[model samples]
Target: MTQKYRSRARNLLHLGSTQANENFNQMVSSKAPKARHYGGSSSLMNRVSATVLQKNEGHSYLAKDLESIPDPIKLQNFNDFVTFDLETTGFGYCDITQIAASVGSSKYQSYVYPRCQISVEATKVTGMSHSIATNKLYLHGKEVQGKCIRTALLDFIDFLKEKDQPILVGHNIASFDVPILSRLLKEFGLHREFVRIVPAYIDTLKVARKVFSKEEVNGCYKQCNLVEVYLNIKYDAHVAVEDVNSLQQLFTVKLKDKCTDEDVYSITCKSCKESYTDVIKNKIVSKVICEKLSKDGIALQHLQLANRRDPNGLRVILREHGVPFKKCEDLARKIQEE
Candidate 1:
């Protein structure tokens, strides 16, 4: 454990899980959806202070042994962001029903009309049926699951493009929602360009741990369950609006404190597997990274699969390709904007 995280862990212990979370709900999570709406970056924007939310920190008592945690970013820049969640019909790389996004109190909810029978595990959790999703969900045959879902997404993008911008949000979005949705969108040939400003995506569960639950629990394990976060914040479970609402609450509560992106970025690195975080935090640098990847004889298009971000990931590729980090960072942004 480094001195920084050790200090963080110690502070988290005193906050006690529940109180710490509520503070975050009130401070940080609150500003997210609206922030993404304006084309900023990240779900939350501010500096991070462990003491701001937690009175005492929790640690595993050692720093080196603490490398297994999936460090999530306590993102800010709520100036332009969206709060989104999905009630999937199945888990892990499968189609889902109920995809909901919210900007402040206003929300966008739609159900996908499944082409096949709903998965049993999914059925157990969400109680959604093929019939119910098809017959009852809002976008059954429109632009989305039907025309309605599709239209909502289209309108959502247009709204995002217009000053609002898209910052796709949901629980565990990076692992399942993003990869699956991006594939689905491209497969269907849907036009999903985001707002003029580059979109900065966030996952509420990740935000919760980064801001509220700073204890020494395994970040990867903690992130796997959204219910854990809800319960910790003293919020109700199993309801889409309520869960997203809780996340929003979490976002607002913890962010009012002063914290930097570097803090969140470092914490996130401890949990998730990625090579370069510098790119994850900077869009222009990431753009430079894409260029470096191409120069290295790597497949640029394939590397961008689903916009799965990591400045260091691309940077490592460049390093292997003998490209200078500063050169890639400086040039890629220019290329991307042009």
Candidate 2:
């Protein structure tokens, strides 16, 4: 079927299923992971009981209005979504330094003080060093203040709650961000409480990899790294807010059109495939510009690559033309105007 027809059918099915208000218990949980065990008990059960009993201060409405709530997967127009990103201290997991999320125009961004020291490698990549994090250092092209991780998590949760718990969108979030968030929430004894508030997620990283499986750069494969996917976009990486902004653009342009009711959680992405695709795309883009400018015209024409939003593909083309960074930017403007 044509993409348009498929989308329309998907929308119709979503609306019809949603209005039916299929029993939550009747709904299969194949897509969702087993609820994390907290102290040898199901956190989801605890949350459901807490909500049903109206024992929670803010969740009284949940008790009165448990049924008829739209199942996340059955939403027709999935526009009510939030994109979020994180900058962490290191790769050890959950040592978040900064977090940012945006839904439509609303935004929530803040830096968090890590419980452990930021690693040199991570600091080099993210520019969030231990000194800067501890001393409230200025990084990522701005002054940053640090909040405690638990406090940061709560604030982000509050932000999600305030936003009505929209679908969470993020790059590589399924693998990294969600687990870290869950771990942090559990560590702080708020997992069961807050897990109920956060909504379903759309991991752009997985979606992009699956949909754009054929795209390659150089001879290597690529996965859904925000930096690589948005190579043409000139945004500093490892900054939570900037990455989310890029992610938002990618979702709108590339991933959103392909979003379906199939539980993304259930769709397992091939790490090897995504990784190879990512590496290939990166190498081809950079190698073409940084190494092989001779194939510029063909690359620009055939690849039709984007480096951010260049006016008429000016930035990338100019780079291939061997223009210096400063001069090429000026020339790009002139070319765009002409």
Candidate 3:
């Protein structure tokens, strides 16, 4: 069937089957890993909860809410931007089960004890359980998962500490890795303000969709799985470092010369004094804005992916509604320039 038809089928028959809604969560958690537990629709971020960003009530309600280094933006000064990933008990409400990151030239992968029972389903694929990998590597005990995720996360932050901008890049990172890592970081005292210092980021998934083609969105929504995108490139772990490596490789193997090469170099971020690519910088600004604009509750539950609005369309939306959008837009534009 066409991607469109398949999506239609999924939506009509089982769109909310695995959602974090009361009924679905109750049913799924019964079989899924207990650690992978998720709260449901109520736990999601509003804007990301659904595709609808606005309503035409003749107007609409409001809402809010990466990557590469070129040669010019290389990590010449500061530490590396540390590419990473997390294999959670479940995508929505489930807790983090395994965390993996690429540190420098090597790799760091950990199967964390989800502070609670991991769901049965989560174990089938993730191969994780309550006793999974204890003493196998650096670990955060189920009890310590909350206390030390941020500390264990420091392994990632340290690598990004160079004079250059530490740019964290990964596949599906903006939605998955960053949020989880940020939550853990806050628990560790990094606080909200210091996040800006963590270097820039890039989600190859986002970049590919925005800058390249996204007919691939079909596989899950309408066409092909991520594997289809790089049918030639083999991916193993479905885990972090490997996925990041796969994504980083995609830019090279698939895009070849089309992708940014040495021409664009990393510039040092004023704050970190670390070198990071311009491409990564752009994503950082975009992310910062998303955090600023995101509406509470709903946006978290949905895990929305905010898109860049065209200035002209934005002007029209603001002018017509008499909202203080211009000022906000001005700030975004300023950040964009920096």
Candidate 4:
């Protein structure tokens, strides 16, 4: 026994610790698991790959995978939906204090120096004020240099023109923001140019009502409340830029798959008007299919012509445009019946 111990002592002194090997083995076991028969399946490779990635890159490796997954609704013109918000001095004959808009990663924000006085209630909510003596603007009690309403509106128009006839989206924009914007544009003689650059508007308040149940939204569709409900986080509300950012996140996660062009209201010289196309009005297909048809300029007249020429022609065209086979058949059938 003494000889055996002396002979093994040198090797034992130089032995390496097994901690790292044990940790890696534990990670692999957690992913692949001995109880499950993953050894014979293709999922084993995926599980091993995930384990390796986690070991090398930490837990943040899943972020890239989440990003690579395609959105459920494939909008050909998704960039056209520009989420925007406005902060004003007060309601009823008030002037805009701030304007902010966002599309995908692009964003625009500007402060406007109002001609009228900033009311007490508005200041309380928006933290905006204007000094009569100095003729300067302030937000959250900090003095901020702002453009006149004319320059701000011109800059907003230029921002919209950067996209292809952007559709303005906002919370309660139809009854509140749009009316106020329309009045200001007309007051500044910029309505025609504004409508030319922004062809339509979408009110997210109306969209939330359609997408979420009264119970689900907790019977309140306020922008701040909806953001908390959908995104599970609270944001700084009443600020124009933060409001638009939260709104864009809400729409992308919850509303994009459910909304259609039919929800859009056309911008006119004076007010907004519903401008549903014949295809949308007739309900010939799904929202995604309708969007594809609109993107390709395939109107009802084109469908009628194709149906007259060959009964299966419309189906072929829709399929070629990446519409699912089932949706193509349904659209063709509906068009033929029409």
Q: Estimate every model's Cα lDDT from 0 to 1.
A: 0.45, 0.56, 0.43, 0.75
TM-score computed on alpha carbons, candidate 2: 0.53
* Best by the TM-score measure: 4
For model 4, what is the C-alpha lDDT against the true structure?
0.75
**Mind giving the per-residue lDDT tens digits that candidate 1 earns over 105-174?**
6766655554445676676556565543224333222333332334544654554554443454556665
Better of 2 and 3 by TM-score: 2
TM-score of 3: 0.46
CA lDDT of 258 in candidate 3? Answer: 46
Q: What ordering of candidates by lDDT runs from best to worst?
A: 4, 2, 1, 3
Q: Is candidate 3 or candidate 4 better by lDDT?
A: 4
Ten contiguous residues with the weakest lDDT in model 2: 266-275
lDDT of 2 by residue, 1-338 (tens): 48756645522331223321333332323222356444455565655544333322334445333222122233353446788888877775548888898877889998876756777787787887655322444474465666767678788878877765367788778778776776666545565556466535677756766666444433222223533645556677677888787777777776777886543431112221232344246443333232222211122322222333446565655655555787557544533443
lDDT-wise, the better of 1 and 4 is: 4
Flag clash pairs in model 4: none
- TM-score of each model, paired residue for residue: 0.47, 0.53, 0.46, 0.58
Which has the better lDDT: candidate 2, or candidate 3? 2
Q: Rank the candidates by TM-score, best first.
A: 4, 2, 1, 3
Off by over 4 Å in 1: 1-78, 132-149, 158-166, 195-198, 212-238, 255-338
Per-residue lDDT of 276 in model 2: 31
Maximum-lDDT candidate: 4
